[model samples]
Target: MGRGIVKVWYDPEGDFLEVLFEKKEGYFRETSDDRVMEKVDMQGHVIGFSVLGTRNLAKMPLEVALS
Candidate 1:
């Protein structure tokens, strides 16, 4: 485990949300859910995640495995 600041961002116009556990280069990949994406480094460790259609979450809670 590592200790560091976690970053969160939300775009009202896009209805999207993103969270980052580490500040580094990574690429987003598909997860079990289509609305969710996991960002991973070259080594495949989960560094962050993003959510699409965030505004719809109010009607149904989002649930998806990161790794």
Candidate 2:
């Protein structure tokens, strides 16, 4: 089997950054924090995550759970 590849998509216009663990079809669900979202597949596996307002948030220290 081959190793998994992570894909990152950043939109400067929207100031959004998405880090995809798997390049598959999935939808984003809001997490406990409004600035983050978790992407899951049909089976609800955390395939990736997203960060909103990156430019603004970069000024301060931030942390999030990814699992």
- The top-ranked prediction according to lDDT is 1
The number of the candidate with the highest TM-score is 1
**Candidate 1 lDDT over residue span 1-67, tens digit each:** 2578889999999989999998879899999889999999989999999999988888978889888
Q: Which 10 consecutive residues of model 1 have the lowest summed lDDT?
A: 1-10
Residue range with the least summed lDDT across 10 consecutive positions in model 2: 58-67
Question: What TM-score fits each model?
Answer: 0.90, 0.82
Q: In model 2, what lDDT does residue 18 have?
A: 90
Q: What is the lDDT of candidate 1?
A: 0.91
Tell me the spans in candidate 2 whose CA falls farther than 4 Å from its real position.
Answer: none
